[model samples]
Target: IPFSSTTKYQISIHAMEEGYCLLAMKGAPERILARCSTICTESGTQEMNDEMMEICDRACTELAEKGERVLGFADLVLDNQYTKEYPFCAEPPNFPRKNLRFVGFMSLIDPPRPQVPDAVERCRSAGIRVVMVTGDHPVTAKAIAREVGIISYEEVIEAFNINTIETLPPNLPFAKNKAIVIHGAALRDMNDQELDRILYNFREIVFARTSPTQKLHIVEGCQRLGEIVAVTGDGVNDAPALKKADIGIAMGISGSEVSQQSADMILLDDNFASIITGVEEGRRIFDNLKKSIAYTLASNVPEILPFLAFVLLNIPLPLGVMAILCIDLLTDMLPAISLAYERAESDIMLRPPRNPRKDKLVTRKLYFLAYGHIGLIEAMGGFFVYFAIMAEHGFMPMQLFGLRERWDSESVNDLLDHYGQEWTYQNRKELEYTCYTAFMISVVVTQWLDLVVCKTRSNSIFKQGMGNMVLNISLVVETVVACMLSYLPNMSYLKFYPILFRWWCYSLPFALLIFAFDEFRKWRIRKYPQGWYRKETYY
Candidate 1:
């Protein structure tokens, strides 16, 4: 190529400015003056003899065969102004471009991340298949993949590669080995059906020399096989594939803006281990959401049953409407919110992902748990407080039933109690307000245990610990709020009265009962996951 025709230019040593012309430096001595340039491999190679070339070729082959990256070395003799303005013009005088010297070659290896092997093993243990796709040469790709545990260090008999000539293989491998390495050239001509077939069969794979479109096709093919694909990339060319994936992960430090914008997740540390941490964290969040929802819903049964009984049995309402509002908006609210901060159960990542079609936030088992089991028990606790207070003061449990009309009356002043005390309408009305306060306190107390139970769905409370300081702080706040709402002076608008502290203490055992019962249920569920009892009772 002519000097002007050459779009790019490079330095040369042991050669003149006029293309290897035999011109010596000024004031020549035995030692060459290398003031303006440096001695490097490109120069070293040209001066090297045929024997040296054969040695370098062998060294490079050995290094490359071991999957090490090689960099060629050559000698570059320094020169003055001539190097800066070296003439590439048609051989000035009698010079020709030839002969230089070479130094040696270097083999470098970029070691894999320290945590990568462990993370890859964890993914394997979780039954998650990981595939590596890169623009590197096949040897380098295979080496890195093996280091990261994506592929075992074995060459399978039915391996696929760039060597395949047909657009589709004459007969696809049956995938007994499960590990296959494919080049971008092999995938470039593959139709979607062929892509799907290969991906659907192989559990472990590597794609080398892939273009951006080939990567996008791989992601789409995975989705076609109902796989939840997570594509990770850092380049602008990777944006399309990242967007096409089910979940896209972008490296925050190394990623291009287009890829980061297209991705659903960002790895701030640009480490493969961070993705595993993210997966664990994501599973915890989902489990915590379910717990928060279940705890929030458990309080509803106790809240609604009071009104149901009042309307049916004609008793003065055990819990007032405003009190229900207080339980939902005040005492119960923070505990439910605190559940979001709870840590995961022990086996959060050990189990497979719950099927989207089968597992739900509100399942049949959850409904039975909230409204039938725990809720039924809590509702009984509330009524127990109500009846116990009414009976002790004057009225009997049976007499209070069917008494809503006379108890709430403006005219009636004489209601006979089982203790033979004749109570006026005003006195009876005050007692009814006290009952509402007791019911509210009952819910508050039981819900504290509910919070603890909800900390873990299946794991024992002892096993998970009351995780997250927020839960403890919220429970404390719940207790104080319940006390203030029940006994604050002149707070008639809230329909709460200063009830006896004895009624508050009376409800403690029921809360303990709830905690013990839930712990037992958890044990049963864990011990017998496939048993009919667990299937029927687990939420």
Candidate 2:
């Protein structure tokens, strides 16, 4: 949800009720949102209406019952005393995508370098349009645009004469298409109302001589268009816009502490390049989160399959408590940790910025791939282990090897002893304990192999790369420590690891099978036109 108001005097309460449970005040909107339940409220020059107060009462009641929190205004108040004794600040909205416009005060900095052209080109190629908003004179803004390589004469030659241009001239021709430059003269006589009217026509607009209030107007106007606007500012005059934007971005080095406080993201280096880098990092983080979800949901499949098969068939249960422990802790977690380091794919940025309306978990195809194909491979590997034992040792293998029934049922133990083994119920318990140990060991090795498999698709494991070396080393070291810890008898606490050297040899063929599957997948993807990694694609 997004909103903007021109006046600080009064705002509709409906806007304030749009999902914020807690309201922290450093601005009029926040103050209004915070004081929704009060009979009357005032912050800065703004005041609340009776209708607003009524809405606030209902909202407060709803929030209080749910134990939802709202804080960071003048006084700290907990929503529900009984359910939530502890006070907590409101959590920031978790938007799937963020859209920000950087209004460069043209004369305030160095000329746009050659890199600016390439950057602009890259942005447009990535479907991010650029607009140059400046307080400078029209001629100066045009000159800068030309030198920056964003404007060509063909885009200008047939247009009105430069001498004829005046303050508050009608909207220019290329406003809907290529990059635009808004100069002081083009809208100097225009008040907030007229400026907003002009700005509404262009999806993105740049302006010069924009005041703090004007900046706020720009932010509000963008919000009206349903954009997830982020405002970047350094001057004291920029505070209103900084506070008004959906997410405020501030310069850490040269910007005032007030600007920094008002912002959600701070640019430590205070370079335009840093903003691009931040965007890339944000995209990667979002992508990795999707990967993590995929990893977790897929690992659950193999853990549940054998038990389901056991119950449906009259056959005895195959997975013991120790085995379940092994699968859950050792087999499942390590590979997931390794997956966290998967490099951002080449198309991550090439794809258009995700729609702001989308959910945080944006990549559904990848998740399905993880859960469907990858989980099937893992289940097959486990089934192969079960079958290998059954074929070699006969029916005794089924009685002794199944980890689930061994740990959970005593009847299963009696059945195992009935198979002509010298073991009593006590000895069967001890062997069950050993089965857990072996399971844990297998789980750990299998998880490591899973990590190794995920790291390479068509490529050999040795030829594969961890794009981020520092992160890769950290994950590898952590996995090694976890693998060692999974082997401890009691420390393995769940008795999940049962390392059998002979059985371990089977892992090589299972891994090779995954390799073949990956190679086939890669080939099919490359053969299709819409495939993300099809021929001539950029990395």
Clashes of 1: 22
lDDT of 1 by residue, 22-125 (tens): 32221101011112122235433233445545565566557755667654433333345435346544345323322323434556787777999999987877
Q: Pick the candidate with the highest lDDT.
A: 1
What lDDT does the true structure give each of the candidates? 0.75, 0.50
Residue-level error in angstroms, candidate 1, position 130: 1.7
TM-score of each: 0.77, 0.59
Clash totals for all candidate models: 22, 24
lDDT of 2 by residue, 1-539 (tens): 22222222121111123333332222232233443333323333223456654564465434323322322122112233312223332234332111111111111234554466766555555565455544333344555656554554333421122232333346655444533445443444445655554555444444643446556766786677566676677656667788988878888888988898888888786765666566667777776666556556655656677667667643334346656654566446555665556665555456567676645473456555665666666666665565554445333445534444454555554433334444345544544444444333343444444555455323444444556464455446644654565455565355444445676665446556655665566555546646653322111
Of candidate 1, the 10-residue stretch with the lowest lDDT total is 27-36
What residue runs in model 2 are displaced by over 4 Å at the alpha carbon?
A: 1-110, 113-122, 149-177, 183-205, 209-213, 253-261, 326-335, 338-348, 362-367, 396-446, 452-464, 467-499, 516-539
Error of 1 at 415 (Å): 2.2
**Alpha-carbon lDDT of model 2:** 0.50
How much does candidate 2 score in TM-score?
0.59
